[model samples]
Target chain A: MIHWPVPEPEIPAGTHPALAAVARAAVAAFRDARGRFDRTQLAEKVDMGADGTPTTRLDQLVDTAVAETVDAHRVNLISEEIGVIDNGSAVTLVVDPVDGTSNAVAGVPFSAFAGVVAVDGEAVESLTTWLDTGRSWHAKAGETLPYRTTGRRELDGAAVSLLRPHPKSEDAWLRVSRRAGRVRVLSSSCLEAALVAEGSLDAFADPGSDTHRIMDIAAAAVLLPAAGGALIDAYGRPVEIDPDLSRRWSGIAAATPDLAEELAEEINRPSS
Target chain B: MIHWPVPEPEIPAGTHPALAAVARAAVAAFRDARGRFDRTQLAEKVDMGADGTPTTRLDQLVDTAVAETVDAHRVNLISEEIGVIDNGSAVTLVVDPVDGTSNAVAGVPFSAFAGVVAVDGEAVESLTTWLDTGRSWHAKAGETLPYRTTGRRELDGAAVSLLRPHPKSEDAWLRVSRRAGRVRVLSSSCLEAALVAEGSLDAFADPGSDTHRIMDIAAAAVLLPAAGGALIDAYGRPVEIDPDLSRRWSGIAAATPDLAEELAEEINRPSS
Candidate 1:
């Protein structure tokens, strides 16, 4: 048993009702899964997800609860496991119901529920809740967030968090890691991006892994800029609120545009 | 501000009262520091630690609090920043007041307060509190703990948490990382070790950087064994409760002796 109970997210007032409901549902489902399942059982692969990854039992439970919650709100949802739930509503919720499913099932305690509210294919608001502790980061597009970025402009001495390196991206991963003042692989993109928005981390990047599907980063695209940070793809592709689960990006969330570009440059640099 | 409040630790009732008081003091001081200082101010190098590492302001603050608490308890203390406080008692508290000082000061939320009650040179009891969330793991040396290890015996197909690779230890780090099914660098030693003790991770290791001072790993010496796990030095040095802050170990905490040995072998292997 994970023993520790998941706390309720301290969601702020005025959050979109649908987004808040989905976050609560995700958290409740996650807590229930932890309570009922052992680590191996929670991690057991129950089905193949739409994003070409195996869905663990924990992910299945949380994603199902989120899908139902999104339905109750009469909103469309673009999420990793379910792919797309179209309700013909212009308001769509892009969510990673359990963003760090591996961490969640393993009891590593870095998982999150991340969601973005998009209308007319444009993200207008986002919420990321660290499931274990219920601490949350909420932001609206074009609105000044109470939290702020470090406003750091360079990678020379930046604190960077990254996804674990895949074989194909090993060179790029090492390149950026070698240049950064500090490097961490927390294995949770949404939580790391929340860290960036709150000025805890200078940046969080995929380091050319191209591992981020739309739901993995749609929230960061809205939240980063609201906190005076930048979100860009390392390969110069535009990040957008798209319903296609097939598209991917090497998403980079940074304290500033200059630092994001610098990180992209470093990731693309040839090894000596 | 790292606006989220730190909660009180959920320590078990039978824990040594001195350990409980000291944990409370560390948490209180850490919360106070977070309230009073900005990131830059908290991260400022306030003094040279007895362990030869520069003591961050946050470390100094927590260490002082821990020290004062130990004095009030009339116990000796062996710690990172303050070194040995020999009060002529047979009982000594080995502590890392802020295990991940960088994470704490930067608001990354991976820091912890880890301590061991040592009697005459052996760790008899331990407690590790995740300061950000107040989740704690407590154990006594020869007693059975409510938590248990995964009982994994091999590194292949295992989940491993590791310290960030140093330039000198990069080869060793990659060797284990490639073989493990998962890799993480959460940047908090005691929390990682606690995870190992509770079976969340198959192993937590330093690879071969030899970076752990006695206080960095003393808690695991008691907690791991109590939880049916193993704690060993990668280089085969006996991990003892020592007052010598200068002694370093490439600490390996794993689910079982076999996995610890396998991790040690992999870490010491020459790169191909």
Candidate 2:
């Protein structure tokens, strides 16, 4: 037998107590439910989510675990499966109980549990736990010792992750694929964005499509900017995470503001 | 500290002892060198490999470890780095010391140490060790219990992994991407093929370019077939792995022969 260190949850000081509690609850719930998750039950569709995606049995199990945790706290909750729960609290907790659902179901080992706390539509604190590996990335908005992004600026030798292209955006996807030195499709937006923030990946590009929801980008929005990177919409504008589940944005999470702008132009440029 | 079961090295009883020893050496060599590999040395191109790719410093370190092990055996060897060595033996061991070199250097955790022992131009035994996790996949020809591919036939819902598309085949890559339910660029052909063998992924398609050499496909050629899947050339022809580093093939590894043929047609179909 080989001994591996169990990760101790460390909630940074100055984070909202409620937010820290939610994050802890999320990590514990996922760890408990993951062991009991039956692979045979993965394909069973439990319900249609507010986001129009089918909620599998695995999604329901994890969603309920996280929802119950957030419900205990007096805060508004916005999630993929259960559109929104108005708790009549000042802060809103945005959560994707299980990001990369397909990967989880298929045992790809690249999914995550993600959550973010927002105050009056501005993200203040966030946490992302890699479900397969117990490592977590957390950030508070105004912390001095923030995480940092790599100083890589060019695409020629840069490693970038892109969302799988929709049929309409094939040309744009191809152009980006050709230009970037290396391209990957990890299928987890928040985790990939966290990787960009930590300098493992140079950037993550989402083609201008209605693919990403608030729950998907909330944690990343806080983590990236805090890490010296920026996650912006296709027009190089700041992305706002409202309580609405229907709002979708196309954007890039890059190591630098300059790289984000450069990628936005490259992706949005017309093909000659 | 939590106790995790260490994977016991299990070489099938009927397998050739020499091939099994090589597999063990490859795994141990990778695990030892991986910990000491520095990221700063990743970009130092020490030499141009016989396979035409620039051999990075990390590659040389692991390659040397693997080569020394193979040299002790009375068998010919073919590899990406030092070309071929003839030992006046009937067996030819094909090895890719570090598949997915970029991913290893960048901390992507999806690279592998892949090897295959061939007898008279036919892959007789194969091994692929995932360097990130200590899990391994091995197969011997004529074994009753081979690995299996998923039963997915249609492309509409298939999860396919492609080698990053080159500029000339951007249109073909787009066609595959649009038709498949999910498309991933994992960069490691051997690991991706292992995923296909174990049914984690439905298929792994290598675009018809000179991107893949014998060392890259040797293990997949053995394991995929044993698992009730077919790894064929883009023209739906059987791939032949010889002691040549210069031969390249465009291929698709599907869960079934029918699916392989379908993908070949889809990729080779005229781009209108």
Candidate 3:
């Protein structure tokens, strides 16, 4: 019975009208599907996604809603189930219709609908809506940001969220967990990054798995930077946001660039 | 915008009236504190808990409210902050006023207020109220259960939640994560166990840590078993629910006894 403040969408004023329209449409579509998200229906495998993950019925439905909505705009669409849709526009909208599909299917209440708008391979705007709660975080490339990170410099007693490690990265996961005071695996990249942006978490790391696509991290890429944090690849390089749906990378989003670099070193350091 | 069915407390008619009163008081106290749970106040270390962890301001406040309310009843109390309150009554109430204190402080929205009533060293009634949302799950030893687990028997493709491994148990964590189809570290033991009872998760494991006390797992012990699932120690033995705040045990709650036993073996298996 903890009464949390009801969060409202914080849309930046400088956002493109078309982008705002598309984001609103995506949210509406997700809201519709969320109302009917049944456990049995959610577990039904519909098809294989472009990323080689199996698509559940809920995934296919939400993807279609977001795809059709974004297709109305004069921008290219990069998504998971449908891959790349060439709209012949300068802007590319990277959309993860539903991030953390497993949590949504299982009613864990931590999934989100995320979309990021980029121009010429550079992200300009981003929006993420928590599907369970209507709260949202939106950011524009150069506008004054609404949130900021904690700027905690030390790893001791730091709280971090990590992706469950792939077998090859098990040792690295152990190393990082041993260094930090607390480790969490929330299974939603976008939401975890959002938590970092809002200073609820110190960092979110995906050690060595190339499981993250542009659609998954693009929104976070905009959010973390705008909030004075940084998201980078495992080698401590800035992540590129291209419209290529097949590409994958390992990355970490931290409250500060220094922390991001430190985490990269810890994650990439050879195990003793 | 997901239309979750409003969760009402499923209190069995056989539940002790005083126990129910204490549970309600705990929920009220939590709700009051949750209204103003700012990060700064939440992180203020006020005192050392009886369990040896540092207590936050929020923890002390909520613990005080619950303890005061429970003390009004004719029963002994065993809690995290205060070791034991001997009321000269045979029935003892074990309570974790706020489980997942870190998550609560960080606004992770996955914490819970958990309690169990033990009569003559036997857990007879349990209750867990999700702190963020008002959803609650309650169970009595002999009454019909409110929810049931998925009964998913296989380890592969099953969604399981584990506590982020302590450094000493890193290998066991790797083994358990590799065996499951998906792994999550929600960091809230009671709420995670509630998820298992409600079928959102297949299992929840604590590996080999002595972090879990009776207050944390006592509610789950009753709810899981009544829901046709089982919670057992790391060695696959039934977890004894004595009202001892000082004792600790590692445990797992799964949809079936077979799944629990399987997880125990996987965690205890010799490393290659």
Candidate 2 overall Cα lDDT vs. reference?
Answer: 0.76
Which lDDT tens digits does candidate 1 get at residues A161-200?
Answer: 9998789788888778778888899999999999999999
Put down candidate 3 lDDT per residue, B1-272, tens digits, no spaces: 11112233444466677666766676676555556555777768999988888898878887887777767886888889977888888888888888998887777767887888898889988888787665677888876565678898777778899998886677788888888988999999999998898888999999877678878788988999888898888865556765445677787889988898888888888878
Assess the local accuracy of residue A147 in candidate 2 as a C-alpha lDDT between 0 and 100: 46
| Model 2, span A1-272: residue lDDT tens | 01112234455566666666766665565555445554446647989997888998777877777677777887888889987888888788888988988877766667787888888777888988777665678887876334477767777667899998886666677778778888999888888987888777899988766588888888888888888888887755557776666778776889888888888888789977
lDDT of each: 0.92, 0.76, 0.78
User: In model 2, which runs have C-alpha deviations exceeding 4 angstroms?
Assistant: A1-40, A73-75, A88-91, A119-121, A144-147, B1-37, B144-147
Highest TM-score: give the candidate number: 1
DockQ of 2: 0.60
Each predicted complex: what DockQ?
A: 0.84, 0.60, 0.66
> Which candidate, 1 or 2, would have the higher lDDT against the true structure?
1
Query: Quick one: ranking by DockQ, best first?
Result: 1, 3, 2
For model 2, state the Cα shift of residue B238 in Å.
3.7
Instruction: Please give, for residues B53-86, the per-residue lDDT of candidate 1 as tens digits.
Output: 8999999999999999999999999999999999
